[model samples]
Target: MRSQDENGRANHEAGMAGGEEMEMVEVSSEMRRRHQRPRKEEAEETEEAMSVEQVFEGKRVPGWREQLTFRAFAVSFVLAVMFSIIVMKLNLTTGIIPSLNVSAGLLGYFFVKMWTSVLDKAGLLKQPFTRQENTVIQTCVVAAYGIAFSGGFGSYLFGMSETIARQTTELNDAQNVKNPKLGWMIGFLFVVSFLGLFALVPLRKIMIIDYKLIYPSGTATAHLINGFHTPQGAKLAKKQVKTLGKFFVFSFLWGFFQWFYTAGDNCGFVSFPTLGLKAYENRFYFDFSPTYVGVGMICPYIVNISVLLGGILSWGVMWPLINNQKGKWYPADLPSGSLHGLQGYRVFISIAMILGDGLYNFLKVLLRTISSFVSVVQKRGATSTLPVLDDGSPITTSPAVSFDEERRTELFLKDQIPKQVALGGYVVIAAISIITLPHIFSQLKWYYILVAYIIAPVLAFCNAYGSGLTDWSLASTYGKLAIFTIGAWAGADHGGVLVGLAACGVMMSIVSTASDLMQDFKTGYMTLASPRSMFVSQVIGTSMGCVIAPCVFWLFYKAFKDIGISGSEYPAPYAIVYRNMAILGVDGVSSLPKNCLTLCYIFFAAAILINLLRDLAPKKIAKFIPLPMAMAIPFYIGSYFAIDMCLGSLILFVWELINKAKADAFGPAVASGLICGDGIWTLPQSVLALAKVKPPICMKFLSRNMNDKVDTFITSLS
Candidate 1:
């Protein structure tokens, strides 16, 4: 039977190639009867054809039994587990560097790659694996794991430390006694870490279906799998694998040069300089640390912008005012035994900037969500219900289906009948959020928790909107906004660290590996890998990583504390909050700038109105503007991403232009080569680090200098 056009929607059973515009069809009872049986028959016929081809193609492997061999399962499990552990270690140790996260994602992609390749070899599926499949799976798994683990572990560790420090310090000051209850704090943190799982559910639909973000790491993995499946891929893989081995050796040598020679104190090599102009420095300065820049590159550009913006607003605007008012804007010389004035200024500025941004963003999100909800309800009341089939069946026989059918149905049903039933689901989610809110906010004081409850929904809405636009997750934005608000309320010194850590976790979970995951998913969809399997693999991998992350963080925190360097244990932002609380007291909460809060409220109100309007509009118009989300994100973050968008557009334009001039294969091959080259570049560094070799050229210069200083310092100091 010929497939019906059904408007423009592609027939899943048809197995059509290339990009074609397809229309979505509503499968009424008749349409289902017409198409379902034929599709199943076609699928069976295709399977038979595939089996015949396999018999002629090569040696026949047994069907299900052969595909699920012990060897394959063992390899997949080991790779997944080991990769998860390695990724957790690197992420916890290195902060949220994109490359590290991407590498971790690549490991996850490998499993998917292997799974697909094995299936192809067995001829269980007709379509062979592609690089894109690995990319999507790896990206999703890495992103999901990164966000959850980072947010959970980071929050638990930092929150525990700050809460204990605050309570004990308070006790010590008031009663002239010291308290040691690190164990209690640790126990409390473990309990709170479980809350991280709650975030996963709300985010699942958004990440998987609505946005359809692609994970690049999964694509890489699929490439590997494809290599094993096809003769062409196999030959190329062999050559490339050998080259990668050599590259690893080269990278290791280069990595060591900087690590050994130019990285220590007094070599003038490894200082972390705060960017922009410092009031005390009287000029802009640069820090000569390679680690920070390398790290900065890996960090999401949006985050960097947010951080930098916060610093600028605080130091460039707020601090100068405060200092000038206090008659200490500038001193002729450094104060006796005092902290670096510039650093101190920047720290304060950063704190205020966080306060402003968090406040503004959170309020906007809350208002937008509420507005969207109300608007949805209003639309339900006004719009005509979907007409049932003539046979009195609820299913419609339309060739075209609407987007968000479930939501529309729910709203329609809610509006058609009683007022009380309509309010039930809304109440349930709210009640659940509210009950969970206290547990989530348990570390904070009751009043502070109250404040956070008031603020969190706003941030959540903003995050949802932000996610809608760029196909980026907004977990970090919400978490950061939450932390900042909490810190501002609780006092900067005591609450800052807890909030910072929590924010770090949130950022790590949501933002760190988002792009890679989206790319992977897109590949999987194209390749026709089982979505259920991909989802299962992601959950399993992420859960394993999350389980062990806290322990690793604790160990790092202890080591850093001993060395008197902040390291992972002491985030500078949190420290600033603690100090402020000690000096200023709770009255400081009153001192929070009203301008920031007002701005937040304005954004929130505007978002709500936009969401309402969008929801009330016709579906066609609604498609053009995700107004609910647009209201939630800050202008600054949007602007930062605009830069990325422009760059991407330029690249695409150049590629299209080139493709027009050259063979179609040339442009695609060049693009593929660029991607492969980028991925390959990391292998050399990994190998070199493993081998403990000095790198060549400029890297060697840095390494040699580092070694000389270490030797000299050891002799003189001893």
Candidate 2:
């Protein structure tokens, strides 16, 4: 339950899986009763919601028809670029991104509000910024940055390259690799990313209204938008922005200062051996990473602790033990990166743990979703004839409806995207994908594409339904399933690696976008925004992302020659892991180093057992149990980041102890500023690197013997 949002990837999963506590919180009873409320009460409640939403003088809440203004789109583009850069940087570096939905809403409000204020002062204001418009900006900006993660630049997409392949296998893998190209990447995204929107259009009411799935991220975002439109909320938001700006500058300057000494590999404060040389050698040092510190603050306490625990267990214990037996367990003379050596233990064990955790959650959520569906259906009964709207809400003349619920529902269902449009759009998009994908990958057959499309909607529905319930999107897990399935189906000779990667993208995009769209719908629902405007903004944002993500990635791709290499600035840890998975899917366990499968099996079982114990344990005890997925991260990537993250968590812990209320109020803004500043630094840093500008110093650390030798050598040279 270490959520994807915690991973610095897609916020589809929102923040760190707040453990199992969320599953224990029931919304169905309350939602069902609210839905069954009487008609007269519903009308009055609806009137109240309408009155609240119409905060601007003489201005009604803009309808769906008038919400998608050019101004909103323009502001969304600016925020989209800003967020995309931050998201993409995190994706490549730690792959742990906090949910920025609230950030997006706040920033969107700040920008548009500033612009409108100027116009109002000049007496040229034609329109006021409404919560619905803010909702659009939030939806649009999130959709755009989401592409940075779902687009797979740091994972499966980049995983299909020779560079990543070289990290896993000693074989001549260049022939099998399919390196990324800007044109194909953009085209591929456009083809697959939008279909998910269509796939879930028909299920909006079923998921939101009937099932009463609490998409927490979306709901939280809606609340932020609603609050931002209030007079008091605006003042607080402005203060938060100023705080965010202050920390952002401090973080950026800190990064700039650190950069001046990072002229060579392992130079600068980033690689400081804080725990002494021995611990540093084991990857135990704090890298002084602001991004991870920020991520640590944003993630739940359990997640940060789990990651640190995993790192200590792996790098501090297991790895050293395994390395000792290298001559017997693996070929002693093999290169460090070789799969037939130590790297095999690192990669496969991590993968096993990842797959293990993923499978358990997948089954757990699937069962929960099915149970919920059946229970809801039974309640409705086969003989019951509730007149349902096209959007799936019951046409109840109930007078007991809550004001917030009825008003939101009215706005939500006001303009249902037609059932025909949803169905036809899915069909046409599927047809186009089936026809074009084979040409794109060639190894991915038309039948394969057709089968994937046929199966995608069902999986998309399952994923969307599960995410609504858990606030955890298993998109990558689903994508991993695709990689194994398609890779095995195609086999190695047919370019299985590329085929599997491509299929993963397709499956992931469909499921991911569908859930994302649903999440946005929830946001829209609570904010009294038009469903149509939400849909349009999502589509527009996604379209922008399809183009923006790759171009941004291309900058890093071209600028950083060492991007995918292990120990490099942006190792893209998941890329190598993903490619190795494809290799395993094709080559089977025979490719694993000697005894590697045995270790993988042990850790895999261990992961499942850990999860099982956490679930069975009492709530107080379960909160302390380490997450297998969080632990597995350090198994492959090493423990340096864990130190950085724990520091972040420690800072927050101290702050909270000092003043809980203030900590809760401004903690995220502080974290966001730290994260955004460091994240944004990468853009200019990449530009400088691309221009071949070098830091004037190389702050290297050496062993005592090596340092003396270097001094002696320098003396000789002088």
Candidate 3:
């Protein structure tokens, strides 16, 4: 008789390609039980989770004692500005960023706590800072951090405004669509992001209450704030909020000194020693970016290792191969600004890998969403009231709806945003998109705007679903897919529309902000924060981000002076990818070298296969499949970041090794400070440059002809 696997495959609609191998791997119950993975057992363990109140409820002060306060409002604004500036600078330069909520919370908690202590000593203070104030303040900081980077909003665009302007000018001379001005991009994104606020109310029930998503990152933040502010933990050392503040301040100042005193166009140091093998010079060296260390500190070992492996494959192995056949695979004299010709081909492959990984995960989440919703409907045997599009058509409605009287209370409308307001906001944003998009990036096909608006809500929902469940925003992935999907609609006439690409930015902001909001709400729920207050605070943070992000971008421009030029101090890599992807949307992949295109397809397929196999594999085995973003980012940039990140992570790793118990208690505070320390100093350096003040040390870009288009555009606008 055939084995069970053989019998199963034989009875299926399509026979398994390797039934014998499948059957061979199938083990008997005794063998399987003995060899079952630790991870599998862990997953199967039906352990109780910590309740929200336990995780977030203040052990010292207890819970829900305070509403929003003036102090919370003021502290939130200050922290938002600080996070926005640092995040903008890091995203523009190193192209790697870490979240700052915990760090900001520690700092906020410290300031108020320290001051309160002084007041108590002086006998003038009525009350000290509370857990409620500190939590709300940090929540705002995290929201601002979310919106200031590549996947969040147009901050990435403004960060690369010079490059966009230059790309537009180059295209203008070539008779392509002239890209919109930096201000236009900012204004559009600001409005789009603000309108996303309306999403917060409706999404609460689905994302927060009913689904009860894990939101791992937010949960961690909740714990961090709670740990520091927990009135009295059983342990003595666990209660020091002041110590975390010291770490944040010390790191922030250290970063300022470390980078500000450097020479060259970039503060980072890259060593490219040829060692007599001239062809391999660029492949061997360290490119140190401090934030990489901070980021790695927070990331898992799997991600760190994956990034390192990817970098080795792309820069160390494949780069040499491509270089060896330069005349055929690429120009013997590669494009000057393209990281020693490695980027000329490696970028395409990296993007393909990144896109493949992102889309696959998205598809999984999408299925999860469908399944969850279906399960809910089936269990309830009920109908749901859906909203309408601005055009008066119902977005989703089932006639076989109408629940029992008791079930009617389960409607999503309870304690959510007013339906009419959400509908109105959608209509206004849609009108704004359709009317303004064409005028900004004139070359886009007309319907592309409509496509953006139509899909924005859907994208927001799905992206939020992923974020709520796993705290992975997937906005960058969805943005790339959007560019392709909308641009594909251009068809044979033109490969892609510039408008479609711009819309990609807008939709990215829309969805990312919505996801970020959901995370913020999770924190709010745990802390017993007012939903309406968070909305107001988040909107304020978004507004400040729009106002302050440009200044920081300009500051970086002043310090670097030649960012857009090839081989400049700041490569602004994310911008380069954005520029290229937008072009690809308009022009097909045919413009790339045949070898590069082949490599992209191959990597894309491999990424897809790996992701699919992970889904099929046991939980233990699947967990090791280095996350796609983790692997692909290093390939896209270089190994320098991965190496540095690992170094940062080693700090945590070693801490855990020596003292596992306290590592979780104080590790986040240290990590947060490490991330923010080197970043916040760039702002002051920016101010010094604006005053025509010569710095104690000045580093500038070393490109052959770095364009100052950003300065020129700023002047023109002024």
TM-score of each: 0.47, 0.91, 0.77
**lDDT head-to-head 2 vs 3, winner:** 2
TM-score of model number 2: 0.91
Name the lDDT value of residue 558 in candidate 2.
Answer: 94
Badly placed stretches (over 4 Å) of model 2 are 1-59, 170-175, 381-399
Give a tens-digit lDDT track for model 2, residues 240-289: 88888999999999989999999988899988898899999898998988
What tens-digit string does per-residue lDDT give for candidate 3 at 201-280? Answer: 56676666555565544555555555565545313323435455566577666656555455534343343222222322
Off by over 4 Å in 1: 1-107, 110-140, 147-149, 152-156, 159-251, 262-344, 363-472, 476-539, 558-718
Q: What is the lDDT of residue 388 in candidate 3?
A: 15
Candidate 1 local Cα displacement, residue 453, angstroms: 11
Report how far residue 310 has shifted in candidate 3, in Å.
1.3
Flag the better candidate by lDDT, 1 or 3: 3
The digit string of per-residue lDDT tens for model 1 on 531-607 reads 33343344444443444343334444443332112222123223233233222232233333323334334444554
Point to the candidate with the largest lDDT.
Answer: 2
